[model samples]
Target: MKVLITGGAGFIGSHLAIRLLKEGMHPVLIDHLSEELPHARKEYQLKQVFKTGPAAYYNCSFLEREKVSAIMEKEKPHAVVHLGGLAGVIPSLKDPSAYIKTNIDGTNNVLACAAEQNVKHVIFASSSSVYGEQAGVPLSEDMATGRVLSPYAASKAGAEALCHSYRHMYGFQMNILRFFTVYGPWGRPDMAFATFIRKLFHNEPITIYGQGTGRDYTYIDDIVSGILLTLKSKESDVYNLGSGRPVLMSEVVDEIKHHFPNVKLLQKEARIGDVTSTWADVSKARVKLGYDPAVSFKKGFEETVAWAKEHSDLI
Candidate 1:
């Protein structure tokens, strides 16, 4: 199978590309290498993917409809995985327009191009943020969306709707995966775990917000596995790709302290748009796609820290 992944140079995208190559599939990647993140980090990720195996790459934004269409026409991939977007709840609040434009509008372009090329399968990368401020634990796909707390969450919800519409009209297989707090090697630097590691390495204080909110921190490998399963499935539906384990922020801090005993801590009020907790109910995915997350938080964190130490320059 030939697969095309937007944001292919990103953390999850790069990992997915390497995995696909190992499975004897061709992977084509498109990434604008956004200014929000360091180009060095993205370039490093690409290097890792290339080192693993051969893959085609394009440095272009999906926002450019013509370019996206041209790439799709040229590649004629069996599947398209849409993962490009502006991420982060706090950053979304500061500039909601950017998030809306990239997440929603950019998604539309990808889907439109995929439909035009008659792609067989399309996987839209949504987020757990769409479940926003739920009092309930273990969020499921059947739950209502658009109760979003942040513009980023709203954008994902809107993009999911677009996915549904395109699937209905074009009659193509559509799989929407709502990812939780994914972390592991090559994780985004803006993520809480990444920031904590960076601060600790420099002997700087790490900030804790909102009385240690809980999150379902899924490992990057698990997420990639879930995506691969969906790619091979004939059925099209929404699935939550998460660990189904919620760990409090305080617990995460304690885990970090285990590595860096002298690490300083700073407490601060939670910023707006931050959810109190996120827990994924992967029952549907388990039954439908045999999606099982293997990595425990402790093990995943240890591996992440080890990788961070080795590649301190990238972070």
Candidate 2:
């Protein structure tokens, strides 16, 4: 099988590429590399993941509809995993038009191309941000997406709805994976985990928003595992990818303090678009996709800390 991963060079995309390779599938990755990521520059983890398999690279933006279509035509991938988009919530707040253009329009372009080519399956990466600041606890897939806190979340929700429409109209298999607060080594720098690690290592005061919002910090490996399962299942579905346990921001800070014993923190008001807590009810994923989070928060955090220490200069 041949698969096209839109954000192949990215954190989750790179990991997913490797997993597909190990399963004897050829991976074709398209990434704009729009953001300057110091750690991801050399593709260190990406190289390791694809070190032993057949892989192809394309430096292209998803917004370029013609280019995306051309690549789909040339690759003729069996499955399409669309993961590329404007990823940061804060950035989306600052530049909403860009977020909408990329996240929503870019997704439409991918789905349209994949539908045109009759791709067998498409696994899209949605966010838990779609839940917004609901009064409900343990967010389930059935809950209606509420007032989007930011353009980023709105784009994701819009893209998800677009995907459903394509799935229905084109009869294409689609898996809309709603990811919780994913964190671990090879994570995005824009995320709090990476930012905290970098700031603490540099002796810079780390900012604590909402005095530490809680999240279900799903590890990268666990997320990759769930993704691969979805790919192989060859079924269209939506499942939450999370650890099923919410870890508080204060707990994360406390863990850092325990490890470093010298880190400084600067408390601040919780910014807009930031949710107070994110807890996933993984019952559906467990039953439908056999999704099981293998790494606990403690283990995952330790691994992240170790990676941060090794890549201190890069971070």
Candidate 3:
């Protein structure tokens, strides 16, 4: 079957596209190559995984309704994996308007295009940030999104609602994945793992926010596996893509020090829009999607360290 993956040149997008291709599915990628990220990563994904020529790449913004609609109509893909958005919490605070427009509006455009084009299914890449520093431990999918502290979280929540509305009215299947702290090889440079790895490599001090806040750091492989299984199930549902095991920021720092040995620490007050902790209760994903994360934080971190060392030139 043919699939359309928005943000297909990105970290999770590139890896997910690779996974679909390996399963003999053709993925048409729509991404804005705005020179925002390192060109090396873009070249690697475009050349390595998509080199076989079964893939199509469109360097267009998803917020442009006419452009997205035209592409969606032409492709008429069996499924649309909507992974495009204005990422990062801190940046969302700086430019809430841009985040709202790109994420919420862009998501609306994708849903509208999918509904109009009659795509079989639309899968959204939501975020655990929507939980918004919940008082409860092991946040569940059923929990109400009560006070979104950041514009980024609000946009993701809005996107989820839009997808649900389309599913309810149009009978289109929509799967929303609330991915938690995804990290590993080919991960985004903005994330903690990549930033920390870069600092370690440069012998620069790594910053720790919220005095070692805890997080459920899910690996890329496990998150991708959950997405693939959810696609096969073909059900309109929400699932938590996370390791279910939380790691404190201090613990992460300690682990990094073990690897780098000379890595210095620069403690800082928690930045605004930062969450103190995040833990996911994956019971729903386990039962409905048959999802089970196979990687441990320790193992995943070790592997990521190795990747950082090998790809030092790129990092």
Candidate 4:
């Protein structure tokens, strides 16, 4: 089978690409390489990523409708893992228009092209942010999405609705995977885990927003497992892919403090668009997709710290 991953060079995208290769499926990846990452240059990373992998690469934006369509027509992939979009709530606040254009419009173009080409399945990367400011534990997929706290979350919600409509009209599988706070090696610098690691290593003061703002921090490998499962299932449904363990920001910081005994700390308000806590009710994923996350918070954090040290030059 051939698959197209939109953000193939990204943390999850790159990892997924390698996994698909191992599965003997042809994986085509297209990414804008927009983020200003701290570690290595995007070009360098892409070179190292695809050096020996049999995956194909296209350096472009998801908003490029014609190019995207051309790729779909050429690749004729069995599935398209649509993970390309501007991520992060705070960054979305800084440039909401970009998020609106990329997440919503980009998804529209990709699905339209895939539908035109009769792609068998499409696994979209939605976000837990769609839950908004709801006061609840174990956030479920069926819960009503309240006032979206950020443009980024709103775009994901919009994309989810769009996928539903397409699934109905086009008669193809569309799996909306709502992801929690995923972190691991090659994770984005904007993410709390990476930022905290970099700052602490540099002896810079680390900022903890709402100190207790917890997240269902999923591991990278586990998420890739879920994506591969969804690709095979061809189920038109929404599933939450999370660790099912909500770890607090304070606890995460404390763990880092263990690594760096003198790590400085600073507390601040959990800025707007930041949810107080995110906990996923993975019963549905467990029963349906057989999505069992194996990596624990302690193990994942340890691995992340080790990765940070090895890639310290980037940090």
Provide TM-scores for the models. Answer: 0.98, 0.95, 0.96, 0.96
Please tell me which model should have the higher TM-score, number 1 or number 2. Answer: 1
**In terms of lDDT, which candidate is strongest?**
1
Error of 1 at 86 (Å): 0.7
Ten residues in sequence with the least summed lDDT for candidate 1: 135-144
lDDT tens readout by residue for model 1, 1-315: 999999999989999999999999999999999887799999999999999999999999999999999999999999999988898899998899999999999999999999999999999999999898985488999885578899999999999999999999999999999999999998999999889999998999998887858999999999999999999999989999999989988789889989899989899998889889899999999999999999999999999999999999987
> Which 10-residue window of candidate 4 scores lowest in summed lDDT?
36-45
Best by TM-score: 1
RMSD, candidate 1, Å: 0.9
lDDT of each: 0.93, 0.86, 0.86, 0.86
Task: Tell me each candidate's RMSD, in Å, in order.
Answer: 0.9, 1.6, 1.4, 1.6
Which digits, one per residue and each the tens of the lDDT, describe model 2 over residues 1-315? 899999888888888888888878899999877754654543675576568687988889988889988999999999999988778789888899998888888999999999988898998999999988863389899874557788889999999999999999999899999998788877888788888888887788888888547888899999999988888886788999999998887788879988879988788899988878889999999998888899988889999999889877655
Model 4 stretches with alpha carbons more than 4 Å out: 35-41
Cα lDDT of candidate 2 equals: 0.86
Candidate 4 residue lDDT tens string, 1-315: 999999887778887888888888889999887754532545555665576477889988878888988988898899999988888899898888988888999999888988988998998999999999765588899984556899999999998889999999999988999998998887877888888887887789988887557889999999999998888884688999999989887778778878889988788877988989999988898888899999998888899899889988754
